[model samples]
Structure formats: structure tokens, C-alpha cells
Target: MGETDKHRRIMTALIEALIAFFKNIAGVYVSGNLMLYYEEGNPSACVSPDVFVIRGVGKNERRVYKLWEEVNAPDVVIEITSRSTRLEDLGNKRALYAELGVAEYFIYDPNQEYLKPPLQGYRLAQNDYAPIAPDAQGKFHSAILNLDLQIVNDNLRLFNPHTQKFLLTPLEAQEAVEQAETENARLRAELKKLREEK
Candidate 1:
């Protein structure tokens, strides 16, 4: 089923932010809305997650995720769920991710369709999933990525705990650069005026 525009935007932003954050690190793969085939022959054992990250595997382009070939399942999975996919995201898909050894699974409801708090995280422990508790500010930490996940203004965002900074999307990063350029130009003009007055 096709997702809402907001859902698509959120997924794209997250994928871009994650790629920007982890691009320098080797063996970290970030992908979005790709078919994950767990079984070799049987096509039924497949699922397409909104965004996922797998570590320790060489960063390479793949048409579809093949668990057998990769030798590892996604360490983290984020599902941008809505009213239509809420049930699957919370139930069957959740269980499937756990069974596949996904270290952390997060589900976010951008539209506030039905999920309470709109963000939830779970950690795989002992082959079972345990609820990932939130911090004082209600941010869930992803141990796999060493980053914190939170909802800001009803949008799912990633935060770097170590840096105490939120990961900026590509658009946000570009805007930041432009703002810096504008500030530098203003400062240069002020300095020129001061030199002339001197």
C-alpha cells in the first residue's frame, strides 16, 4: 500500500540524515523501503521496512536485501507507520523483526493515527523483545547506532547523544550552510566599514 506524503517525507529525511551521520564509518549500511528476503527460495519470507541499518557488512549497493547473502539481518529498523499499517507494524512485523535478530525496532506514527506517544522502541533481548525505556526527555536510545530517537514537533528525529546534537536532514544542513554564508557576508561588510572609518 502506498503511504501518505508525510510518511514518505519522514522516511526520506531519516534515511538522508542517517546516511550523512554514518557515511564516514565503514560497514554501516543505511537503506529505505527495500525488499528484505530472509529466505533464499521462498519469497514469502520477505518484508520491506521503511528504514533500516545493518552494521559489520561492507557498505554496498543492493537492489534488495538478501539475508542469506548478507549473513546478517538489519541491526536497526524504523517503520513509519500510519492508520493502515499500524497493526502490522505493531504486531506481525514486530515479531518478524525480533525473530530475524534485529537489535532494535522502532515504530513511529507521524499522523498520530493511533499509537500512544507516537513513538515506541523495542530491544531484542535473549531472542525476545523488551520494551526500550525512554529517557527523562522521552527519547529512545538506539544502542546499535549509538544515537537517540525522539519526536520533535510530531516528527521523528535522530539525536547524537555523544555530541548532544540532533542529526540534520540534507535540506536542513543546506539551509544551515546558506545561513552561515549570509552571516559571513554581513560580518565582512561590517569589517570593511570599520577599516574605512579608521
Candidate 2:
């Protein structure tokens, strides 16, 4: 399934946002659209999840994730589903992740045209993936990452419950800082004007 530019951009943005959010956390690795080599010596047997998080793994760069080398599957795996890859993402990939012991599996439809709810999640229970219910706000909670996944205006968003804020992408964060600075400057000017009047 070939992805369009919009799909690519959304995937990259979400991955970058997660990376930025967890950059300072030790032993946490976040990546997107990278191959996970499950079976040794079988280069053909690999799955590249759209966004994945492996806890307890060193935050290092890798061309491929050899599960045998890492000694464990990713704690969380997210698939950015498209019209072309919808079936595979829902069936084959889900089965593979469950068989490989991925603790959590999530599917996010950026286009919001395929998946019924646009976001779905499952938690590994015993030997199968159990569906994780969404909250009243249509946010799926990831116990592994301890974050809430939601769709705001068709964009996939990750919310930090601890901070009660959405995890912003790099660009978004910069824009936020700039906005704060601009507001601060405006307030300072007003304060100076008030002092002059006094």
C-alpha cells in the first residue's frame, strides 16, 4: 500500500512528536516506519510499524530492529493505516504483533476515511490482544506509554495525562514558545505604558 504525502507527513510528525517527548527519558526508543526483523537470518520476514516505542531499550539509532538482538519486541506498536493497507494493518500486522508479544497495538487512521473510529487500541492479555476502550473524549489510553491517543480535527494527537497537555511536534512546540514570547512582550509594553501614566 503506497502512502500519499499527507500520510507520510502525518506519520513523520507523530513520530517526531513522540521522540521529542521522550528524548530525555533513559532506556526509551521511539521510531517510525522502521523494519522490525523478527526472525533471525530471514531478512524477508520483517514488519515496519508506523510508530513504535520500545521501553528499556537504549535510545540508539538503528537501520533495522532485529528483535533477537534487542531481546524483546517493542512495548508499543502503532500503525498509521491508509486505504491501501487497511486490511493488512488490521489483520496480518495485528496477528504478527500479538504473536511476537508486543504488549500494545494501536491503529490510527490519519485520513479518517477507513477506520470506523479513526483510533483503536489493544492490550496483550494472556496470549491475545484485548481491546482497550476509549474514554468519553474518544481517546484511547496506552498503559505502556501512559498517554492518551486522540484525534483532534482529523489529526492524531497524543495527550500527556500527567501534564494535562497534548504532546506537540517540534514545529508546534516552537510556535508555542514564539506565541508565549510575543504575548509576554505585549504585556510588558502595556505595563510600561501604565507606569508612565502613573
Candidate 3:
């Protein structure tokens, strides 16, 4: 349709891709543009994070997440920088998430104009979020999720330290499990043949 609609669609696709990728990993939940209601003064003031994660939340697709229903704010909230929303994301949105007691805050600039390299992270301390140190590779670790945020090949990717592997999507995780089971069965059969020969 219009240019704005096209941009929104593109962003939505990107968000969905990231969420799907992160869901393949165990103990992580990624949501995008999920409405987070806070105050009652103005419904329009509701916040929808571009991307967020809550570890150990289990694997499931959610149509929408209500803050009051979830009983906890997201552990990590990521904001995708855009021309119209860059200022708000860096300012009001940051303050709002901090006041809500979110554990971590991340900002990314897909345009790569204002925020070059396009990734920043902050960890909540006491009543506010303090800047977090990025690793030598310019990747930031999430204390809450225990994952690293890295820009790989111009796209933000989630790195799982426990598995020392990049998290996969739901389908990928399923396939991986199946593949492992098949390999294990093959090895077991080979071992049985060897024992018989002995």
C-alpha cells in the first residue's frame, strides 16, 4: 500500500524472524510489539516493545501479553530505532521501562545512521538501568537471560552461552532433537555389533 505500511511490514517480518530464532533455544521467551499497559490516565500511552525476552518462561506462541497478567515485566526489552521513534525510544520509552523495573534494556538502530553498529544494552540497578559493558566483539550479555546480543552479518542475533550455540527457531530445535536421537540410535547399534563380535 503506502510507504509507511511497507516499512511496518518489513519491521514486523524482521521482529518475527528474531523471535522465531530465539524460541528454538530452551529457557528463553521472545516477544515483539506486545502491548504493555501501565497507567490508566491515557490508554494511548501504552508501550509496545519492539523485542523482549523473559528467560525460563517456557516455549509457546503468545498473541499478546498483558503486563498485569504476566505478573512481571520483561527481563530484556529491545527497541528498534526508526526515524520517527528514535527520540522516544531513547528518552521516554527508556524512562518508562526503567520505572516499570524491567531488568535489561537494549536499543538497536537498523538504519545504522544515528546509532552506528546499532546495539546498546543496559542492566537495571536499584532504581535505574546502567550501561552494560559489551564484550570485545561488541556483543552485550544479558544478565537476566544469560545470552549474548551480537550483531552478526548486519542482523542482531542471540547467542546462548550454555549451549555455546546460536539459538534456533522452533522448527530447527525440533529437527535438532530428532537428528540427535537418530545419531544416538545409530551409535548404539554399532556398539552392539562390536560387542557381539568380541
Q: Rate the local accuracy (lDDT) of all candidates.
A: 0.93, 0.89, 0.74
Model 1 residue 165 lDDT? 98
Q: Candidate 1: which stretches are off by over 4 Å?
A: 184-198
Candidate numbers, best lDDT first, in rank order:
1, 2, 3
Backbone N/Cα/C clashes per model: 0, 0, 0
lDDT of 3 at 185: 100
Look at candidate 1 and tell me the lDDT of residue 129: 88
Screening candidate 3 with a backbone cut-off below 3 angstroms (N, C-alpha, C), the clashing residue pairs are: none
For every candidate, C-alpha RMSD to the true structure in Å: 2.0, 2.6, 5.5
* Model 2, global lDDT: 0.89
Candidate 3, residue 125: the lDDT equals 91
The per-residue C-alpha lDDT of model 1 at residue 117 equals: 74
Query: Once model 3 is optimally superposed onto the true structure by TM-score, how far is the C-alpha of residue 111 displaced, in angstroms?
Result: 2.2
Query: Could you give candidate 3's per-residue lDDT for residues 1-198 as a string of tens digits?
Result: 122453354346545645665646886777777777766555675788877776656657776665665666778788777778889988998899889888899887765776755788988899787988898988899877677887776566678788887655445568888999999999999999999999
TM-score-best of 1 and 2: 1
Q: Which ten residues in a row have the lowest lDDT in candidate 1?
A: 109-118
- Identify the leading candidate in terms of lDDT: 1
